[model samples]
Target: MTAAPTPPSPPPRRDAGRPRGATIVAAVLAAVRAELAETGFEGLSVERVARRAEVNKTSVYRRWPTREALVAAAMEGLLEEFGASPDTGSLRGDLHALAAPIAELAARPDGVALLRAALATTAPGDVRGAARQRVGPPVASASSIVDRARARGEWRDGADPQQAVFTLVGAIVHRTLLEHADPTGEWLDGLVDLVHRGVSADPPP
Candidate 1:
């Protein structure tokens, strides 16, 4: 029987030097993170990030479209700094687990500097809108720990998860970014206790 017409072979994937596209993205992100660590967000620029990353500004702008977009992307690199909040089943434990990373970062000069820079600058281009897209997942995960605690009858029904998240997190941001002081675990522990007492359904015996 005549062989069925062979289906045309799929076109071979073209290299088009596109393999480096992902690498470039990674490099640029790394550069931004490095700059934030060293100089803070205030010192960041597309050119600076590109220079640190060993890439050209054109490539960075082309990939990100705007400075804000790039900043948002850079902030995303901090994902590793954020961790899953502990479900220790105690409000204090849960809050401490959530706040510890933030406190640690706030205490670090690099982290504090970057955050200060981020807060000081006007968001470039579509960056403000893109920020929630980038930081939201981490924020949501952290907040979920609180939600779980509430479900367990640990926290009061009036507790606002988003507000709580921001309140606790904002304290770190304030000390690190604005106050320009070292944040300590002892301080963080106290803050956690304060927040827990405010939200706990039952007062500590």
Candidate 2:
């Protein structure tokens, strides 16, 4: 007589074999950032990304379908993160809030590497454009920040919003990469103060 074998555990249910969507997306996006940080867009390899993500290449392809898509997905969170200005009720406080995160990122090894990678290229293609496409144009957020400051009588007469943001970004880059300095409390506070003076209603002497 033969014994029953539990029918193979009901074939493990229909969708059990499918990869978890959230987990898979997170892994793929993280892998995308890592690959982009290391190789920029030109050197990005699907195989390497898949290997790093611990996912099948098919999974990445099926979801993203292209390097641009992967980069876009990877940068989505950053889009939201750097897009909003906190209303701390003061221009100086708002500027500090805005610049704090970026400066903090520059202080980290992985972050500084990624920051360098962000400008590693200037060509038409590569991660440079993809990054710009995703993270920018940051003008909207900057404009809103300045507008708020203006309403509070804190904005300078002719200060450019884009230029203000650029200055902050440049200072952070120079401090972290060229100067090899930590963008810590005192340094960040000084940075905010400097930019605030430039962006405030006082003329430079």
Candidate 3:
């Protein structure tokens, strides 16, 4: 009888003992943020990110084919880490809470650099679209605060939610980017109070 054919070898487990996919993604993202913090967007590179993350460049390219996409993803992650919006049962308190973190971030040199670089490097449409999504949660929180204030008859009806939210954020951005000034706690409190007064004064529909 002919000798039995040798049994086929089992397929190699290429990913055996490797970190999970989600873990790898998180590592890459963390590396992206670290790179941005340390070097800003102009200095960011896929190879550097891969080295920092201890991940393969191919993996990053596979997920984010372009630098713009990677930057957008990194910014989105950063925004999410800002945590949930505050609901202190009053509009003024909520605005203060919202402005506090922004002011804190603006106070950091690295944070200011990151924001400026992101704004300067990203294409206009890409940055605006991605920023809108990234900022959506906080905007929603602001809207909720407005709704609560309206319910309590503290805020005017027909107040523009978008304008109200942006008023607070715009002040922080102006201080951080245009003036290159660190926002004092006193300044933040005054900003919230001013926006509250403006919104409160809107004529009712």
Candidate 4:
């Protein structure tokens, strides 16, 4: 029998190569990250970020009213898009799962760069506030997981779901962004252990 014709190659992705919104965001973020890694906060500026993103000054300014706003928007987008939520059955497992990407991001070049930039500024305001608020959805999503666990009696009725989410995120932020230290899985596990000790009730024999 004649050999079957080879299947046609898949169509190239249309959006993959374009300079669309995602591209703009990615380019600006990468540029900002690079600058932050090199110069820390003093180096980050609207003009610099715009040049790096390869977009005009108008585009950057229109989207972000200020330097802080730009930085916050970039950070919020990065965290929302790349970070995974905790969902394993046990709290420890869920925490570990959440921490894995965080540890990896903390150790990444871009992540280090972004952290440096974020540290230089006071808390975000105005446009920055809007961007920071974007975190609400993901934060709520993470909280729901913990709440479900609590409902199942896997966790104590008094468990603070919000605290659990923050603790997990904060550990990674502290190690990678603030301390400028490489985040290790062991370190993440330590964080989980600490939270567990604080929150978990002793299981009956």
Query: Against the true structure, what is each candidate's TM-score?
Result: 0.66, 0.69, 0.66, 0.64
> Model 2's lDDT to the true fold?
0.72
Question: Could you give candidate 1's per-residue lDDT for residues 119-163 as a string of tens digits?
Answer: 545555344444334334446765677678767878787877777
Better of 1 and 4 by lDDT: 1
User: Clash pairs of candidate 4?
Assistant: none
Model 2 misplaced stretches (Cα beyond 4 Å) = 1-16, 105-130, 174-184, 203-205
Clashing residue pair totals per candidate (backbone < 3 A): 1, 0, 0, 0
Query: Positional deviation of 78 in candidate 2, in angstroms?
Result: 2.3
Per-residue lDDT tens digits for candidate 2, residues 1-205, read 8887765554332124675788888877877777765666667788898888877788889998886667656765654456577788988988888788778766765455456446666323554554555435344568778888989888988888889888887888889877989987898899889999887886436
Write the residue-wise lDDT of candidate 4 on 64-121 in tens digits: 7777666666565545554446567786776666566656766887666555644455
TM-score of model 1 relative to the true fold? 0.66
lDDT of 3: 0.72
Q: List where candidate 4 sits over 4 angstroms from the true fold.
A: 1-26, 40-42, 46-73, 82-86, 113-124, 127-131, 134-138
Candidate 4: worst 10 consecutive residues by lDDT?
123-132
Ranking by lDDT: 2, 3, 1, 4
Candidate 2 vs candidate 4: the TM-score winner is 2
Cα-based lDDT at residue 93, candidate 2: 87
